[model samples]
Target: MGRNIKRILIIGMSIISSLAVGIIRTEAAEATSSFGSASYEWMQGIESPIGVYVSSDTPIYYMEMIVTYDPEILQYSSGGELEEEGRIKVEIVGEESIEVSQMLYFVPLCSGTTDITIENVIVQYESGETAAVASTSAPITVPLEEGCALKSLLVNGKIIEGFQPDILSYTLDLAENIEKVEVTAVADSDTTTVEISDTSLVIGENRIWITTMNEEGKRAVYTLTVNRVQNLSGEGTTKEEKTRHQEVEVLREEKEEGGNDIQRIVFLILAGLFFILAVLLFLLIRISERKRRNRRRCRAKRIAYQKADLLKKVRENDRQKEVLNKTSEIEIDVQHVTMIFKREKDEATSIKELLIRTIKRQRSYELFKALDDVSFTVYKGEVVGIIGTNGSGKSTILKIISGVLVPTKGQVIVDKNKIQLLTLGTGFDFELTGRENVYLNGAIIGYTKEFIDEKYEEIVKFAELEGFMEEKVRNYSSGMVSRLGFAIATIRDTPEILILDEVLSVGDMFFQKKSSARIKEMMNGGSTVLIVSHSTSVIKSNCTKAVWIEKGRLRAFGTPEEVCEVYEKMNQE
Candidate 1:
């Protein structure tokens, strides 16, 4: 019985000790799960320095950090969830390490160093326990002075405030002639220095470089081009030499007639002078007649040449018409197409009024008729040209036919033919690289990736952008963009129905000629084409038939010459 009691006591002590150790471990875990300490630092921003960022290692479900700042030295303008007096509450969610940040806005009233403290940091855990963590941020230093920049630029004693620093160049037009232009640049700081490349102006475009450098070694350059026009008139001559020759001639004539019967001698001399003057006058008349006849012969030759050229063009046009009439098929037909646009108008000035008008449907709108029952037919192997003035619905008609725009009341029957619209600068992304944009444009035009891959090198070569294929299109010049667009639209695959809208007018002369030749080749290859251009010469030379639209109405549809003649007469009227 003594041995049993001793064993039972030993077991009881062991159990009690185990229970105490488990309790102590639970307490230690609870202590470790409590809110941890935090530290913060300052970061720079655009308007002001960013405030303290309080970071804690404990996984927190909910947290709120309050930042206390000196109102005299620093003032909060924005950021943080809630702001009241000098305290800001930043609430963070999720079971992760917590970081709370706010912007440190400075008060412009005073500039100095001040302490920004983080206080009242409350962190909550998943066990529904909340505790406050103590933290503080570093002091912020604010500069009392602003940075240096160009404050103003003066040209010829006149301040030019309209010049923008972002524009690297400026042009000044002066109607009055000037030999020199006086330029002065003023900086925000007195420590900045200015230099000018040239002070005098010359005829034509004169480029002057104006450079400004701050004390910190930051430099900015501006180019000023001054143009001067010079006067090219002769000066006046003196008057004394004009009268000496007349007095000498009179004395000589009086001496010659002195010893000879003066009246008879004067009569005889006058008669002979009259005969010589008459002969000279007759020869001058003959020469003038001969020159007039020569001019007429030259004009006749020119007219004959022009007539022969016209006849050749007419014959070529006739041949094309004959071939199209015999071998071509109908491609597109438009029957009484009409389009109208609804333009909404709202004069509401305030947000409240705008909301009220929108909710009550009180806005007014008007209908604008862009096309009025226009009709035309296109055939394969024929080139049709549409000509009209601005706002006469020429482009609108093309858009409708190309399926870019649907008519308001009429239907366009394309007869299952593939059509593509080629316009300058359309269907291009300026931010994408030229190579990527080529593929993108090809995809947009219904070409597959495989086809684009095959034609990629050819497209780049045709555009003359071999080395610039990897460069962004925004960096390209307008002519370069135009060339790339034209090359992509014309190469590899030719659509059955092609619609061109003033695309030929873009780029340089060489590109224009290249594009025109490609278009002619397409037309010759039996692709139906519809073109719109403001150039009458383009219409007369390239098109077999012309359609004239005036103020949303079809005025004439016939041969190019006939339709152009009628359109010209109407414009004259």
Candidate 2:
């Protein structure tokens, strides 16, 4: 068993060694072929031959090669002139040749037949002269019949073809990208049949095997690979080629104008500009129309309001006349009425503190001059509306009249009329039930418990919260809350002078109409109404006279229409 194992191991080692030696020999043979072989070819009468013929299946249009010798026989380098060694003067008269009639003959010198030969081809080393001996003395003939035709797919200048043997085998350099390829022998129409493998190939380096085909199969195979390299010329191609391409482009665009990419890009840019312009124009027109509509609506509302104002003033005039007629016999005395709010000075306070404070003194409460040097008198049973933009002391005047905020400079004298501030749900608790709140609010508004109890059913019915009375007030919607508030405010018997601070604007249109009707009803009952509103239309419609406040000062005081006109014109500027 041991002898059998040893024999098998020896056989395996021998096989591996032999295979390695064969591979090395094959590689060496290929390397020798790549550099090519130089041998003398004996002719019948020719002498001193210098050039050799190299034939391939592909056509040899040109050849650029470096001839390297053993340095002893022919010591030569390319580019520079040949450096002759010993007594040998082997010169290449011309390295180029063209085939005429399937024969490569020498170029004629003057009028005589030129022999392809080298003169005095002698070899003289350091010792003496010795005639050079030929290593290969047979005629070296690479038949043109066996050469391959090398050509490019396109005749354009982009692809340049030449010989390249930078590998173990000779090949063609396609110095540009090949979109498609085909290899054929004897042309397409030739009867002298030749064969190749894989005629069509992709755009890359590919091997094209050339061989002769018999009736059975293939023979005499010479595998030659054609390398298609990627060569990019960034000069935007040649002018002639670019012009031809441009002509094709123009024709393409003419055929399919809508599909032209350049035209499409241009069309898209134009369309975007037009779209932006159209949108801007539409926006401008819309804004202009809105402004026009607002002006027309404002004017129409203002005119309607003016008519209502005139009617209110006429009614107020009639009431004043009736009051004067009733009290003609009673003598009313005029007395000097003055009002002021004083700010006390502190000895310890500095000037900076005085500048920062509303009141100049540290010891005194801050006194803001809300209604400084302001005075107004209302006749009996007269209705007035104070119209102003935001922050014009309109609410301050209402507050002063309601006694919620004492004025720094003002006096009020109501002979026999009771003043009441009409606000929306002034005193109501959110956490408590509506029923509990009714009792709490009634007491706060200076009403007795018995009076509230009598009005409880009417308030609940008017607010429309019959079953919701037991529920917490916070649970109600805004509209429902406002409804309850309006009911609570109007449940009272009418006061002599009503001080309303734009509370009717709290709810939606339905509630606003209801509240307006209640206010009109109060005015009809000979109650003096003093109202404040930013809405000039509301003031003009509901009040007998209007006062315009501007920048914390009285700008104008007249009939509602007249004051509102002045305010509107100033706002337009």
Candidate 3:
């Protein structure tokens, strides 16, 4: 058994050894941008455009830069504007990473190289804050010639001794046995092209010319002079020498044949051992798989028993009493409900990972309490706002009330059928036309076909997409879809219990005003509203009651002003 365990462990280690590693870095839902010196051909006696290039994972809104260059070597020609005292600050905006290039034309003062250093570089990505820095140096140099200068010249795959970009010609002598040589010439800029002549060598000196041309139609040639070594006078091998050479060759062949035989024997032994190990590993894995399956079955049975017991008790004691929520005035009741999610942190992103973790006994899964034993009661015609930071059980409670998710512990008593969760893209079919989706969404909301037909024109007008009804819903932008969804949701008489999750308004400013007025009109008509919003004013002004949740536990529940004042203060601190 111990031997089997060792074999199994070895096999497990070898399998899926390339398990995923590395975490993708991100900054608070903001996209990252980078800046680099743009490469371009710079020639003496001519102004060339060479500056910084910006690249980003997302579109850039704008950028402010300060570039300082060697003034004695490079003089500004045109392009970038001069700012305070000695600063050259340029702004480039409304372009993607591909199109974002800030170029400055500069005339080389002399035949030399100079560095253009960038500082205080700020790249703005979309509507995010404009504080991302990307500072890099761009070196400017005038080549030996427009296209004549070689970054490096190689002979037989090796750079010759005493070589520089300024040195345009070289002479190399080949060995007696060296029949041919390869000459590789690399140009200073990608805009230049290099062409070589025939590389084969003859008995005498061979001169080759490498021609280069730049984008500006300027051309230059670098010459290579190669002299092949001449053969020296030699006497022919004698008959005795030939006989000795034949004997040596024969002995060497015989020794090699014996060595090959031993190698074959060793190879066969190793292959046989590998086969045996593979068979053992296969058997061990199968046994472990069966055991793992049995364990899973037992775990699943235990969970089912727990769930069944919880359901039986919940059915018996669902009608809990709350003082504020009298029978006729009560709209919703959430009683001592707790939500706990069980899974690994990474959650075995792949099937191979799942198998590897299972065999290694890596218990990665753990419970996450999304909601604690919290209770809240909502009375009829009361607009209650749920206030909390992200992942504070606001949405979870809404889901539980809307019957989208059941709590792991405790019970909720409400007419789930009469509840409507007003959210964007709730029942949209992207493939269907906006006109068709209007009917589809209306049907899902329990609206009759005739009622939709009567209200179809009004809905289209409210969505402000009357011209786009014939277009596919997928073709519409996110804001357009939100408008259409909001329109369909409002067509129905307000639900007995309205569940809103960060969708108090939709569309542009004009449409948002309309949506807000419409919601207020519905609220005045006396309908229960339960909303989750980050807006403090929404809770203070719109909601009669507010509930504050912190880390899945209820922190405060009172009149909106009382609840929001403390919640906002805590957040500020």
Candidate 4:
């Protein structure tokens, strides 16, 4: 019993000693902070995980820390609970001297400097007492991005006018005598190096390239074009020469006109004398021949006169007759017309090419059908519109009606002489003056010289090109050419058939409106008109009848509204 009691006492004392040492350790314990990392440096969009640790010899029940950071600068992306705006609170709990670690994930919102602070740390020990701890911080840094781009570009000591850093192409037109031009460039960053390769200048086209690169081996390239043209009597090189060349020619013509007038008159007098002598000799011979064939000639003349009378009665007549037959007689009749073009795959550019093509037995060619078995009719005084997508044979059919092209498979029955086919970029010679083109176009339309002379000023006034009549047609702006063509084409106040191929869309918006009004007036004034346009609205508004062609075949023909509806639906699909 005594041994048993002694052993029990020893065991109790050992337990008490251990308990006292543990209490002592517990009383002296204090939490120390250790962060996962002291600093973080990374590029944008990289996610990093971090932790805050609290160590102690005694057990810990709970711990909380308030994390403070700029939300705009750092994102506590995923791990921690967002307690509030720009603040994240983390909590950890354990039993025995636990390492209180709360993992946090961070990502930089943008490239800059910032800091993450863990403060207001409260630790709850197993003894049921709360204690505050000091705070810790970690600094974050993101380096600036890298790019290879030019800041400035200079040519011949002059900075390019619009030197945007991102634009990769530039052009410079040098003068006639310029032999070499200095080229320089600067990069957007100091780390990037620029190299230029612009050593030679050719007569026509000189191309230069400026290359830039950064330390990371990323590269950007910029191109510059230098143009030099033949010094044609000292004029504008790249663009067409200023109008001074035309002005000089006009002055020369004026200087020479005075001396040529007398010479022309003298030549005309001598030519008239020779013509009279030749006619006198011809008439003498005709008198003898006529005596022998008088009876036969009279009979033939009677038959010819009768046939002429019958033809005139049945043939389509002038403006007055068109008005009388408005909407009654067919003005244009297209009968089973098909147009095919022969396109050569390999054209002979030289003698060697010709020989090769012949030797190889290569008759490589393509037959393109521009129109196929198309037939339509237009009545007198009806405004007809032809609508089609581009290259769908809209313009081809017009040329067929205007007698500019003969159909390969069929025919168009219309008064070819009365057709006034007005298409943009046609019927004007670029080498001629605008004034000369006016006369030439009028003469081709069957207007006599005297008639054109009487209406010359009216045409010029309508065209609004009075001061520029002497300029070459090539020198006129597109608007000016369109105006001139419109004026000349509409000079006749007759009821002839008029074919307009997108001519109403030739000018600025205001001019287009004006031209549309003029053509509408003509259409309503008993003129049989045919129009080809891409705009369905134009056809719907102006055309009394409509024809739709698609892929070289007639798709629809009816009222404008119905045809346009079908066409627009097809396009939508």
Which candidate model has the greater lDDT, 1 or 3?
3
Per-candidate TM equals: 0.41, 0.37, 0.43, 0.41
Q: Going through the candidates in order, what is the number of backbone clashes in each?
A: 0, 6, 0, 0
Residues 1-573 of candidate 1 have per-residue lDDT tens digits of: 344544554565455445544433222112111111132222211123343444555455566777777564455654464376666666655423354333334332233345566677777764566665657566555432232245777799986647754444567865335778889877667887777787777677787766666665545555666776443321222244435555777888888778456645555555555455456545554665668768999999899889866865776576555635653476776756889999867578998998898899898899999898676667666799999999999998888887779899656667445877877666789899999899888887777899889888988887888899999999999999999988888875677788888877768898788888888887777778899998878999999988988889776666788777767777789
The sequence of per-residue lDDT tens digits that candidate 3 reaches over residues 280-378 is 766766775768867998999899889866754664344243223336577887766789999776678789988998899885678999998676678
Error of 1 at 126 (Å): 80
Q: What lDDT does the true structure give each of the candidates? A: 0.67, 0.52, 0.73, 0.75
> 2 or 4: which has the higher TM-score?
4
Kindly list the per-residue Cα lDDT of model 4 for residues 148-264, writing each as its tens digit.
677799998899988777666677888758878898788888988888986578798897878676787645556688897666667444334546666788899987896678656
Worst 10 residues of 3 by lDDT: 16-25
**Clashing residue pairs, backbone N/CA/C < 3 A, model 3:** none
Off by over 4 Å in 2: 1-367
Q: What is the lDDT of residue 319 in candidate 2?
A: 52
Worst 10 residues of 4 by lDDT: 19-28
